[model samples]
Target: MSADTVAAPRLSLNVRYNRNVQENSGEEEESQVEILEDEEHHADLRPQRARPHTQNNPAANNRRCFKATAVALGGFYLLMLAGLFIRFTLLQTRYDQLSNNNSQLQDEVKKLKDRTEVFKSCPHGWTGFGHSWYFKSEEKKNWYDSRADCQQRGADLVVINNKEEQEFVSELSKDGESWIGLWYEWTQGGWKWEWVDGSLLTEKFWAAGLPHYNGYYAACCIQQGKWTQGYYSDNKNWICEKMII
Candidate 1:
């Protein structure tokens, strides 16, 4: 109705409209801020879901490491077992060789003992000359000269004490006459043997028919095997007997 009344009404209407627009704009901005905050929260929660699987990767890595370590330990144990097997094989081979050597040594000792027994059981004869049971001199000499040589060396002309000894000596003599200790004793009026140590002959071991003393020509001695007959003047091989000390 009046100008002032009209101006006051228009001002009131404008104030009411600005207030309403400010209130509505403030409400819309608050809603947009709430929505943005909710969206950020949801984004953070999505990453957390993936974080659980990412954390499990370290545990898987730890399990794989444990498996690798276990495999290494097993390999080491196998290597140790292989080394022990090799050592055992070597020791077994050495032991076998030593056992064989010991057996061989025992056999050799037994053979030596048997040979020694055979020598000890041999009959009383010239056993100290050489390895051979009987031996003949290489050179020839008369009976008296041969007896003198044998006597100087603590030996005597081979004397056959029994048939066993005669057979053994006869095989060693050459196919010729040899000098022995048998001789004719003019004072005794019988055939006598010039025994070692100047002892008289009590036991006689002659052939079937021997010591006839035909012209006192043949001079010989009884060896292990046979009667060796040689001329007194002729030089011939002789056998000497030596006692084993």
Candidate 2:
């Protein structure tokens, strides 16, 4: 009876020890599965490392775009200012050329006028009538003295060639009486009027019914568009005439 009882207790103890070892093994397996789950969750929650902060951030992208746009606009502004400066330089050069051309044209026109204008061709103090030049002397002188004065001046008394020339003298003699190149001389046909240059008096402008040969010699003097006979020694204003040289 004592050997059987001892063997039976030892068997019970072995069974209990084996049961406890199996429970501990199960608990360790469960803990290992929990640890694996926690590791997977941590891996999913961690931030990615491939992309940097600048690509995902909105403020950073906007600042980069603003910098690019500012650079582009500033370049355009500088280009426009350079183009304006170039255009202004070209316009200024063109204006200077035009001014030079205008000045040269003005000088040429003045030279042309000086060469072509007949009125300006006459000497000072002389008046041009048609193609002839005339000068009036304010000092009174006799006919012979007037003729000598005209000869000394390289001219002669005004010779009225036509109605136009007669009018010219009439207007010129408006202020006072003046001697013309005409005189009466004793001829074979009695007395006749003649010019100082030995030209015939075919065209005459004698005032109404007057050639009154009261004296032996006669000369012509003009006064206010009228002609009167006077002595060769009569003192009167004189007119001198010559062709334009």
Candidate 3:
């Protein structure tokens, strides 16, 4: 009985061992297939290395160049605008200075015109003729005293300039022998005729050979337009003349 039992159990155990080994090998193959599938998925998820761009892209290069050129041109334009602004400011300052100068000139011109207008007419107590005034003295005195009186009245003895002025004086002084501006005095260059204004006599209205005097100096008096010499102390009426203001 024992022999038969042991033999049957050993044969069953050997068959079970072979069947378990086959099952385990099938599970291991399935697990290996799953692990391979997982590796393939992970490789797909990893970032791929980018391929180098060996050939030049003309469109991209042109875009980069255009950007650089635009920046440079913008900077140049900005500098030009700044320069123009500075120049305009300088011009404006110069224009202002010119305008001020012109205004000052206009004001000066106006003042000159006003002064010209004010000097056009003569004052009172004087008779106007040409650009001067004349006064006839009412009192009689010596030649020296007559000249002094004329000076106190802001004038001097009358000085006849032309034939017309001599005629006028002759007509005005016909009443008496009046003291005239003509006189002869001894100088370094001998005796010569002079007027009260320090000018040498150029024109003469003398009664011929009547200006002769023996003294070192002498005065002249005018009865009419003709001139004659006399002593400086001789009494006479006098005429005065002054420039018109």
Candidate 4:
């Protein structure tokens, strides 16, 4: 094509009609040919350039809608997972608390059962406290003889366990000396004392400066509601005690 034809102006139909009216009739045939070629070229390019965007619009819209639906479904699944995890955690924590409460209740029931067994073991004329029995003796004897008398009756010399036991014995004595189960052991130390049950004496209510040992053979006795050390051969009214099965 010539350069002038390549750069030819693209005019509307109305502009071409006006140009034809103003120009000489001698150039009419040539002008008509150029306008006809320009129109044909424009018609070809209009279909080529515009057909792709128009045909693809529906497909582009469908792709955008599909992406939106996928995003919404993914968010819903994430929310469901989070809710399930939270519920599982709450249930596990509740189960642990219930387990702890059940264990505590079982312990309480066991204690009650043990206490009932101890109460059932008490015989006539014997007082019950904890898991043992107590008896007040009316006769007098030395510490060793007192223990022997208790043994004859299937019992032993009394062991004072706490303030309540000491008070019970003091009340029964009514301000007099009584042989009890505490004695020194040359098996360990000159000063070591323990109950007959082999348990060490950890607490005692003793008279002031009064556990004065008469050599390595001292025994304990209850006097005026307090513990006092005495010779093993000393004579006093005694108390007997026994343990439940």
What lDDT does the true structure give each of the candidates?
0.64, 0.76, 0.73, 0.75
Q: Candidate 2 lDDT, tens digit per residue, 1-245?
A: 88878798776855644565577977566666766888887776564443454356888779999999999999999999999999999999999999999999999888666545866767777898766789898899988899899888888988787887888888887877788888786667777777777776787677787777745233343553667677878788888998663
List TM-scores for all candidates, in order: 0.38, 0.48, 0.47, 0.62
- Candidate with top lDDT is 2
User: Which regions of candidate 4 are displaced past 4 Å?
Assistant: 1-121, 215-224
User: Model 1: how far is 242 from its true place, Å?
Assistant: 0.4
Query: How well is each residue in 149-207 modelled by candidate 4, as lDDT tens digits?
Result: 88988999887788877787777666567778888765565556778878887778787
Expressed as tens digits, the lDDT of each residue in 43-152 for candidate 3 is 76553322235556889889999999999999999999999999999999999999999999999888666556645554565565544577777787877888898899
lDDT ranking from best to worst? 2, 4, 3, 1
Model 1 stretches with alpha carbons more than 4 Å out: 1-135, 186-209, 214-228
Question: Candidate 4: lDDT over CA atoms?
Answer: 0.75
lDDT of 1 by residue, 1-245 (tens): 68878798777955654565578987666666766899999999999988986675787889999999999999999999999999999999999999999999999888667656656765554353322233467788877788887777666776655556555555556455566566655446565554544556555655457646633323334443335344577788776776542
Best model per TM-score:
4
Sort the predicted structures by TM-score, highest score first: 4, 2, 3, 1
